[model samples]
Target: MASVSMKDVALAAGVSQPAVSYAYNRPSKLSQAQREHILEVAASLGYPGPNVLGRSLRSGKIGAIGLMMMDKLSLAFADPCTIALLRGISEVGELENVALTLFPLNNNRLVGRSPAANHGSLALRGLVDGLIISTLPDDHPAVLAVVKQNIPFVVIDSPLVDDSFFVGIDDRGAARTQMQHLLDLGHRKIGVIIDRLNPDGYRGPIDPQRFKSASERIVRERLTGYVEAASAAGLAFEDLSIIEAGGLDSTSGQAAAFTLLTSNDVTAVVACSDVMAIACMKTAHALNRNVPQTLSVIGFDDIPEAVQLGLTTIGQPMVEKGVYAARMLTEQLNAPAGTRLEPEQKIFATKLIVRTSTLKI
Candidate 1:
């Protein structure tokens, strides 16, 4: 059957096409009784009103924002850092009355071509008013798409681009501080675990060459900090046992921690994230190695679990970072059309939170 149209409703209600439009979009243009009568007639005729897409296209406003993340959408809810970040973004989004859309670029090696490679164009083609890019690796092809779209965007951590709004901490400095704490505790042999160096599926045991050329910005900086701290203590990148968790979840962390705890020689362990750090502690306990007694563990991103489990970690304000990134994008969006704002950078400070997970050897 043919769909109901505004013309059909107008004809049934003894009104012109413009009168029907005024009833729905410009109610004040018509008398209240006339508008109500038109609406009732339209409802009886099953006229669903104006095309939202058409209206949005004409107005040049979508009333929504896009978020491009490094991992799969499934991890959005699973990762504590992302959860806190989303909470902050959602708070501002509620006030701004804009919706949030996720465009997770699954960088992990898949059986076939990556889905991000397929749907990236859709995101860049005016799907949302603005975008927030979160922790993408260096030279990600998707970023080129975003730049080509000429859309308003804010980058949250990793892969610092020139002439762009960025919000993050000094990853290298924070990691150096984290490792220095472990070194001060008299730990010589240390194992380090990270989520991934790049989007590739490669996992387990980071070779020195890969360590020198880590592709992910945040990971590279943190690894550099660890290497620098170790070098100061008479160690090199090759001296430390570095393992890639292969993923961001606890299962991946547990696997990496197990391998590092069992295969390599180390008294202390530094994980790039609290999730992996907690996994290191769990693996140590399962192997009959007590935390801070037999094996010391340190983690980055002092998530809530770090406090509950008393895990020493490097703390960055995840929620605040998110809030700032959202605000930056919103600021760009709220500006007059075709007005380009100056690129801004906000580097938050990180602190080393000492907990019971580490010991003074």
Candidate 2:
């Protein structure tokens, strides 16, 4: 097929080559009539509009943002929190006509690997003008991959790099606040369930020594929050068993809860996520334990299901986090080339939602 060119359109429309280019690249340069005539003539010549590849090459942008998460693509979508976050990002993408591409990377693929061993992230080169990565250690391979790319990016569920944008809630603070609720309810023997303790993807009770030396920032932070609150109330950290569910979702939560409920004589359970809380509730039900009466349960991230169950939880602005992060990226992207962007670290607030699932015992 003979691909139509701007020159052909210019010839048909009796305009200069620059005028044809202006019609597409800078429409304001030409009068409306001239722009209309150029469009009409281009249509007559079967010439498509501006070439994407050529424009991207000349403009140094691909009009897309990449969202890289540490999970399988299918699995990332399974969590309601992930969905809510993506919902916010997509809203910005739609408004700006920018594509939001998912780069679902497994733990082995993204973290703890050398930058040279980061094969997965290298694939992102030239794929997106910006990246929004979630939850990695400061020295994670995925984070290194983003650093090497040297593009505008926003960090979520993790710490911010210098001169980059970071959007996340105060996980430690939220965890402390949520755990305090359980403590205030007069629950002395409480259990804590976590998705995972480290990037190694290990499941089970994390050894105290290993937990102390662990690099899993998210897990460590939340656990610290719990311990801090409990300790402040004169409760020893050793009194509570922190169970690593080893995966993301209600199933892992349920399995972990099974161990805690079956063995431990706990009065309440604090799940790090809504899914885990749901699992705890299910486990309590299967064991015939009445909720909020025998085992008061609390969760984080007031997702739709949590609300439906009237579960006491901590509500983070999931969608708003995504929205604001994308908007921050958009600002840096829209800035003139060579303009340095300062680091923007934003921590959204998390609220406690009192519901039927939690009760003063």
Instruction: List ranges where model 2 is wrong by over 4 Å.
Output: 1-58, 93-96, 107-112, 119-122
**Tens digit of per-residue lDDT, candidate 1, span 235-283:** 9878899999878899999999999988987999999999999998988
lDDT of 1 at 16: 78
Please report the candidate that would top TM-score against the real structure. 2
lDDT of each: 0.82, 0.79
TM per candidate comes to 0.80, 0.81
Best by lDDT: 1
Locate the minimum summed-lDDT window of 10 residues in model 2.
49-58
Cα deviation at 256, candidate 1, in Å, is 0.9
In model 1, which range of ten residues has the least summed lDDT?
A: 107-116
Cα RMSD for predicted model 2: 8.3
lDDT of 2 by residue, 151-225 (tens): 678888774566678888888999999899988988888899988866677778766776776666776788889
Quote model 2's TM-score.
Answer: 0.81
**Candidate 1 ranges beyond 4 A from true positions:** 1-58, 93-96, 107-120
- Model 1 earns a TM-score of 0.80
